[model samples]
Target: MAIGPTIGTGLFIGAGQALAVGGPASLLLSYIILSILTLAMTTSMAEVSTHLPSQHGTLVTNGYMYMSKSFAFASAYLRWYTLALFVPYEITSAMVNLGLWKPGSTIAIRLAIITTIVVGCNFLPERLFKSSERLFTAIKIGTMATLFVLSLALGLGGVDAQPPWGFKYWKHPGAMNEYLVRGVWGQVLAFLQCLFDGSIAFAFAPELIVHHAEMPASLMPASVGEAAILSASIPGIVKSDVAQTAFPYILSSLAMGVMAPFNDTRLTNNGTGSGSSPYLIGLRDAKLQIVPTIAMVAILLSAVASGRSFLYLSSRTLCAMSELGHAPSAFSTRNRGNVPYLAVVASALFSSLAFVSVKIPSTIMNTYLLRLVTSACFISSLVSCATYIRFNRRLRAKGMAKRYSSSLQPFATYFGMVISTLLLLGSGLWVAPNGNLTGSRAIRLIVSYVNIGVFSLLFLVHLFKDFVSVAEVDKQMDLGGRSYGNRAGPREPRTQKMHPHRGGVYAIPEASGASDLRVRQTMFTEP
Candidate 1:
């Protein structure tokens, strides 16, 4: 749930953009398409989690046996580092939104502020730390629900029935084929945005849960699932009609216009992320009298939630890498708070470059574009899924003692890999063909090459340190629980038998490969 759902969901914001690009009619089509795609990806993720779930989710242990721990560490490092690029950007966005610090503040002063807050949080007891975070999450959710309810109210009695506030814009929409590419591209980008949003927020949550003193034994195999659930909660908390704005795709519907403004009582523009994406813009266009304070708070909260999450994730990855022997030994040592002081310091130093670039965000169309939060993450996701498929396939083929495997062996793995690759490829091809001023294709080329390139270089340099054969890499995977490898093949008509209980909780040992799990020993450990 974390990576799949928790990733920075650009969906609501993306939906608005889809309406603009694909028009109202096609917007619905795009949502249907992407939702299916998302479901498929989630299934692949679920299958993997059912087997080799770990704190890093699918990224950590899927290929540990096939690749060296160093390889796993490298994948973890690059994804974390790439994702880390956004933390400073999120902070900068919120800081700017708050209008708290003066624009002319000295660099040292800003750094000191960031350092102080981060260090202060480290001093709090664990319970206080989490409670505070959950508080923000709750506030964000409340604000979102309030916005939807109010938007609906305004939208209800032709609320404030104003000019440019009806469904006229959508009624003039074109054929789906006309805006198909635009719709597809726009929504795809939105999905990518959503992925980054959710992924960044919860990527390290499993690691966070793992450190807790009393994690549920069931949660041990659910670290990854937990992340997905949290991610899904955003959409879950808000009804789909409201949440759909997170992606916003209505051609000529009543929703075509109408957005609440800065004041509490007026309707204006619905801000879409794209040209027409600013929710504020929608509120304004509706001529609603929304106060500006609402926008500022939303912006600040976005920065706080998104920024802090990414920073913590980056630090965790650094620590994980150090533990796995991928980076300098200094990172392995944790401080009194179990914080990886050296790794945190080192990562903060590297992530600081974002400060320089983000400050000069005039280099791009908007401050947000500079984040590049999702560029490399999708690539890493594809790699992680593929590695699992590959590792597990070889195991099943040899008739080895399969501990925890998926229902269809590596097919699910292949499915995820192919789809993720296709999405990335589609984006890549789009960027490659139509170069932007920044030439994001060039940036992608650089990021991927550096990973593939540097890893190759590093591997060559330290070839003698640890040589892993395909066979050895195949052996290290431990699907501690929930193995479905031996299940009957999918029926022509697949059926799910979910016998639910009160409070929406149902429990049982439903997996096929129970032999690999030791219930008495490791069952009740932390997630």
Candidate 2:
């Protein structure tokens, strides 16, 4: 369920977009490249969490621990604010299909449908909501399996036609491709769009994956790993032969024609895995309605479950940031229900901005691009990860107790950082004019530089406040121990107590009595 929404409706649609742009070879190449990048980055993310997973899953909470409030705030905006306010894109994408029922339906009808789904589904209580999630995830898989069976049959029967120029033809189309006619600048924007599209899945992972195979218990972690393993292990996603044509692969079979990859209400999947809903995109058309129907239902179920989980996740992000003195305190305050009642209402209000998406003119393709959300989230996560690595190294150097990693750790951490920095820079500024850092487009071009700005602005403000001496911070950090002055008595010397509770076990409540500031900080600040 967590993974589903993060994965979004995009993967199902990416093929057509890719086909229009670069054809089979290019699309497959991009998928492989992005997949490797994501894997490395995620593994690095997992590695840090293995040592220490923050209570606040959004980038802000973890970010504030190492970075500053401004950095954390901007990151929160980049991830949560953008994400929370992203109703227009997501809901629009979710509802784009409804028009197929009544061709040329009025925007009112479409908005109503989207509104109904987004708002109505959220009204359900938590338990029933989660149960439906399990049920829906099952159905989606069953349908996907059926699609694969059909794709295999079609493949065996030779119903789908392969491109005439051979598999690699699409990869080297020059500038003549319809999708790239916008010149290098246009091409750059297009790439950014798709890259951003790819990020949708990554951001949603924390929400979706059950146990990170690393995250500690007592954190009330989420489990959307079902979808992830399913995405990874599904035969359709595997490609022993990358040179094969696109039709036979997952996208064409499941999400392409049936789901119609480019029907854009939001700038979703863009018809490519980085392009479409990868799960649906992977499956093929099954003549047996049960299979595809079940899949569609499952996709919908994921959307529904994600809505609740996201609400909880988003509100709590607001709450956690508030605890860190980044977000407004009221927004962070919780009700007796343990709900960030104000934050939830605020999130709902913020999400209403998605209504503007209704006016964007619904279509099978979207003009609005949302790649920034992906870039910002990944940037924040990766930077926090880089900080985590530093924290761990410092802890180890100081003779602190910690787990040992083999060769994989050093390589993955550094590799992820370099690659993350490159991807962020390249994806944002590799193109020109619009990205040329001059004239009216400079702001937009600079917005493309969100990652640098995210880090810089936060660092500068933290420097101004003197939160941590710039020089000392430049030195290795000690994340396991926080620095508190006389207000909390002389800071306790750094110590390790076996992490107190087991990792990867059931949740345990941390002590939160007001008298014990350390425990309160542990329950709150430690995120």
Considering every candidate listed, which one attains the maximal lDDT? 2
lDDT of 1 at 297: 59
Q: Report the lDDT tens digits of candidate 2 across residue range 410-444.
A: 57667667756665665543233231122244545
RMSD, every candidate, angstroms: 13.4, 9.9
lDDT of 2 at 17: 45
The superposed Cα distance between candidate 1 and the true structure at residue 199, in angstroms, equals: 10
TM-score of each: 0.62, 0.64
Q: Write the per-residue lDDT of candidate 1 for residues 59-98, one digit (tens) a residue.
A: 5444443455455545655666664665555544444333
**Overall local distance difference test of candidate 1:** 0.42
The true-versus-predicted C-alpha distance at residue 252 of model 2, in Å, is 8.1
Candidate 1 has a TM-score of: 0.62
Q: All models: lDDT?
A: 0.42, 0.45
Model 2's C-alpha root-mean-square deviation from the true structure amounts to 9.9
The residue-level lDDT of candidate 2 at 443 comes to 44
